[model samples]
Target: MDWDKLRIFHAVADAGSLTHAGESLHLSQSAVSRQIRALEESLNTTLFRRHARGLILTEQGELLFEATRTMTKRLDATAARIRDSEDEVFGELRVTTTLGFGTLWLLPRLPRLFALYPNLKIDLMLEEKLLDLPMREADVAIRMKEPSQAELIRRRLMDVRICFYANADYVARNGMPETAEALADHRLITQSPSSPQVRAGLEFSQPFVAAANHSAMTVNTYFGILQGVIHGIGIGSLPDYVTADFPDLVRVLPDVQSATIPVYLAYVEELRHSKRVCAFRDFVLEEIQSFRRRALPEAPETGHAMTP
Candidate 1:
């Protein structure tokens, strides 16, 4: 019922010590302890269990902490929204995407974004795990597959395919594979089948593994595979988007490729009017468009539409 007491309790529970919470909140430890006691009396239940080390949350305290955590996030979101100006794009924007795409594609292009909005802060989260947008785990996402989350405003960015590639020197040294069967003589660099990756990419890479007789290297992220290929280790299975920046990589066994993986950009519906979200969405869309235009002619002919 008391907002200040609830805030103090949340802090104390978070730190597991009244002294630590008090230091953070600019209050004396005794004052924080008194507030917690008052809150426990108000709720008619024990909120914490004190021991020689620190306080542990009682069952009731756990429930209240969960509520307060959610409240804190929602309040932070509200404050962020309030701080955003219609004409100025500033403040933190959390973006989530697969590690491969984040490192290979998006991260390199972020300088242009910063050039436009010098004050903007970007928290780039690169992982295979999909973050929950609606729950505020991440403010935006660029995913290989269409997002199934509700209350999300999503846009189709482009279609990407997994293709075999090798550095020019490696190709010159080892010779290019003309057919899937020819891959038997070359060392293959690829994401391990056991690693977390798109089903389509895994399915596409299976035949190559089955065909390879030479030694192979398996890495969890596409970035590692690219590195292996760059250093003349082996031919790698890589996304087509890499060609724009890594122009020296020669497309090998062009006919052997994966089905199109649709890339999507999505954000929570609540962020529809948020200027930062709009700016980021537009910037990504523009970048994708530019990439498609520049890379299309040089892109190996898979005899399929690569654009959305």
Candidate 2:
């Protein structure tokens, strides 16, 4: 198999035109056509069907194209890794985490990370679905629960629990509920049980849903619930980590909380020595430490303890 011919075929198939592929590869259209013809002869199969509009891949071409596409992505990733210096942490780092943590916690702290590594490129993927780290779906992940995926290096970052919270203004207007039974009088805001969330969060929120006699609002993401609480909507079930970022939110029902869920940071074992991955891991650990320190005490006026 000729690597050059395969490369040319991939480009032409991708572009669906001889001229376009030639322009991309800096070759004459005739030269590209010749290479494609040679590749077809070598494979003893028709690779493409030429139409008036452009070229379409034959079944064989489609199969070859799929292999080439995967090869190209892997090669690109390898090239990026090779380009990274041993000491300098600068490259595209894809980080995936739940939408709530990404928006409420990690997003706020990214400016500091960027300030330190000005050349670093961060591709933040915020979703509840776990990306396949070993398959390179994402470079790193911070998951609410310990990642069960194989062929990965995992580190427990911290533990978080869900608790009830409401804006100070909302509390002032409606008064705070000191007991679970008293929650019946106030509106409840929470993540829907059907939504993708940690079991601990769902468990904490279920009691509130059952107890609320007034109107209730159910959002799919914690970000939405946080926003509702910020605007004085009602008491919401939120992770304790959010207290550090939102000092004005008053913790209600201090004794009621969810069992702590372990938060884990994980990446493929192959990336253990990668400079970008190491830098990100260290930065996250340091930031979490700082967050923990800040969350030790409540803001002077909020009159409620921050989540631990």
Q: Estimate each model's TM-score.
A: 0.90, 0.82
Residue 30 local lDDT, model 2: 99
Q: Model 1, range 1-308, lDDT digits (tens) per residue?
A: 99999999989999999999999999999999999999999999999998889999999999999999888878878887887755799999999999999999999999999999998999999999999888888899999988997578888788899999999999888898887888988999889999999999999988778878899889999999999999999999999999989988899987788999988888887777788988898898788878977886654433232221
Model 2, 1-308: lDDT tens per residue? 88899899999999999999999999999999999999999999999999999999999999999888777767766876786645787889999999999999999999999998998999999999998876677899999877787677888777788989999999999998878899988999999989999988888788779877899999999999999999999999899999898898899998888997878888887677788888898899888778877884442222121211
RMSD of 2: 5.6
| Model 1's TM-score against the true structure | 0.90
Candidate 2: Cα lDDT at 19: 98
Q: Candidate 2: which stretches are off by over 4 Å?
A: 1-66, 297-308
What lDDT score goes with residue 7 in model 1? 95
Give the top-scoring candidate (lDDT): 1
Q: What is candidate 2's CA lDDT for residue 45? A: 98
Top model number, TM-score: 1
